[model samples]
Target: MVTPELNGGDVGVGVGGGSFDFQRYLSARADAVNDALDRAMPRGFPERLCESMRYSVLAGGKRVRPVLALAACELVGGDAAAATPVACAVEMIHTMSLIHDDMPCMDDDALRRGRPSNHVAFGEFTALLAGDALHALAFEHVARGCGDHGVPADRTLRAVAELGSASGTGGVAAGQVADKESEGLPVSLAMLEYIHVHKTARLLEAAAVSGAIVGGGADAEVERVRRYARCVGLLFQVVDDVLDMTSTSEQLGKTAGKDVEADKATYPKLLGVDKAREYAADLLAMAEAELDGFDAERAAPLRHLARFIAYRQH
Candidate 1:
């Protein structure tokens, strides 16, 4: 596999004294991730099922989770190639979640990434099966890819465990269940935090921490990465809530203000939009602080990533 360039030099001066070019970093890693994903899943005997899985998995998005994995690996002096499997695994899990999240039993949305949702494009049963397939494939790919790439078996096992935990009741599933149960009901800020922390933050935390583990980070270093990821994960949702309230449907590429429409609990609803924005800023600060002990240059990508999540409009 071709190694991705992790250097910031190609993008010229970065923000705040030319340390890193976040946009370039994001673009490069995203391209690499897309390529890896395309190569990872191929058409199989059950053409329709494979196609359905590929359709949603290949659908465009920011590729943030995979990039986080790669960046975390790079930060710990690991080769980007070593983290590719985990990166792809995270995207697969994310795609699976999206497929399920848009199903009739869930959010029941028809649009995703500016296109028809998985269930709309494919039949509901097929879409559901597709998600299940991808979920299983994520772990399979991680195990096989890590072993093939010569990552230590122990590290690979740890990564697998992290991904599994993040996908199951302790993570996305738990959050989704709570979110569905809480819809159109009076929900407190604590409950809202619980839902987002589990639904959104846990997987991201897994991505970052798994990368560090696979990258051979020390225990203390892994903990720091986890804290940073947790903050950024929350920051991601807070910013999403703010954008849902402030941005246009066109700019967002999906329904805007739908949280309010659905009577769902969001940071903006609980804290007020201004306060939600303030909370996002706080999360960003806390996330960046976690990186202060690392090499400044190596930590630049993560720092900018936190800012990106905090300030992104969509």
Candidate 2:
């Protein structure tokens, strides 16, 4: 498949022959997801913990994971309302990971979302608990919200399991461990791929696949969405690596060149910038091909999403 080039034109129009406005779609869905997230956790007792939780959760960034979940749900003919809980749950898990990942024991980064890292603002212990609280609350929200939204119990159970696996030892945690161990060590392409696939792609895959499962997608349909998400997930990391190499600190919000600075493994380090770009193009083509099995109009958002990730400047 010939993937569309990023020529400063609106690539969203390339999906399904120009019927969708991806910017508009992203803004609207992001607003809805933000509102739901705000309501999901409130200022309550233990003021500091709640405040820390709210701080990270409300911090603005691209709501990419949640958007993917909702879009996948819609593509499977599920009501967006029914998928709201899963969407919020994915964001909560993501936020929790960010909080922990930024702590003194981990990346030790002082900035997140262009603001103070959670541990820096709230102290290390409080940040730790806040992450734990959000992680627990994610499961709780899915359990209660799905039922409240009238999604079937079996589907809710499956969603809960998916979230668990993505957040736990089998997924993000595994990737993080491997990443830490690999630092300063000569990393082969396979090891780097393992780290990226587990740390980044697994949660994304779960997000998209869980949405399909919750939205009543057939087994085969769910598998296809999983494939699409896997391709997009790897593409996301590759783009991030490229941006790290090319963008400046002012442009990236966080410190750019951190990967090279830390001697960490990245696609650009292994494959060269041009080859990394070629790999990203290939991944985007594969992702788009997976969407071809679905209805074109319903699949437009996801199709455009692949291109957006590929071409986004920051």
Candidate 3:
């Protein structure tokens, strides 16, 4: 396994000093991931099911989760390509969550990625089944991807476990349920955090950790990356809450003020926009601190990513 000292040498943050082209880097990685997703998606007996799954999977968000997986792999000195399976798997799980979350029973969102939600584009039942299929496909992709790419069985198993927990009760499901229960109810700061951490942070943690594992990172390296991703995950949601109030549908690509309409407890709702912004800044700083030990160049992508999430208009 790779160790910390061996991860990389002293380096500068790639953003301001080293001239890392973040947009180019993101585009390249996202293109690779999108292509892989297309290739991996099943096109079989149920044509509509396949279409529905593809609809959301290809809907085009930031692809932050999968990109984080790939970046974490490289940060630990592993081949970025070697972690593609885990990266793709994480995206699939994320996509499935988006699909299910947009259904009538859950968040009941109609717009996603600036387009009609899966349930809106397709029938509700088909959208539900497509989500279930994507969830199952995510695991299968990892197992098969490992075999196809020559990753060790132990590493593959560990990645699988990380993903399972991230998508299961301990992660997204738990968070979603708590969020639903807390809707229109007074939510404590601690309770709001619990909701986001489980619902949002855990999957991001799993993504980075799984990528590190598949890329053969030492345990310590994996855990450190997990911490960093957890901060980013919470930052993502906080930014979302702020944006919901500030941006419009034209900018956000989804129903703006949806949180307000739902009477949900959001950072801006409880903490006020300024305080929420301050909290996001604090989270960004903490996230960057977690990368201090790594080669600065290697950690630049993640650093910029934190900033990107914090300052993004959309």
Cα lDDT of model 1 by residue, 162-269, tens digit: 999999998999999999999989999899999999999999999999999899999999999999999999988888887888878888888788888888999988
Candidates ranked by TM-score: 2, 1, 3
Per-residue lDDT over 129-221 for candidate 2, one digit per residue giving the tens place of the 0 to 100 score:
999999999999999999887789999999999989988886899999999899999999999999999999989888998899899999999
Count of backbone collisions in candidate 1: 0
Give residue 192's lDDT in candidate 3 (0 to 100).
95
* 195-312: candidate 3 lDDT, tens digit per residue: 9998898998898898889888898888889989999999889988988998899988989999999999999899988889889888988998999978888888777777776777
lDDT of 3: 0.86
Among the numbered candidates, top lDDT falls to 2
Q: Candidate 1, overall lDDT?
A: 0.88
Model 2 / residue 199 / CA error / Å? 0.5
Candidate 1: minimum summed lDDT over ten consecutive residues — where?
Answer: 1-10
Say which prediction, candidate 2 or candidate 3, comes out ahead on lDDT: 2
State the weakest 10-residue window (summed lDDT) of model 2. Answer: 1-10
Q: Give me the displacement of residue 25 in model 1, in angstroms.
A: 1.2
Off by over 4 Å in 3: 1-17
lDDT, residue 86, model 1? 99
Q: How many angstroms is residue 81 displaced in model 2 relative to the true structure, after the best TM-score fit?
A: 1.2
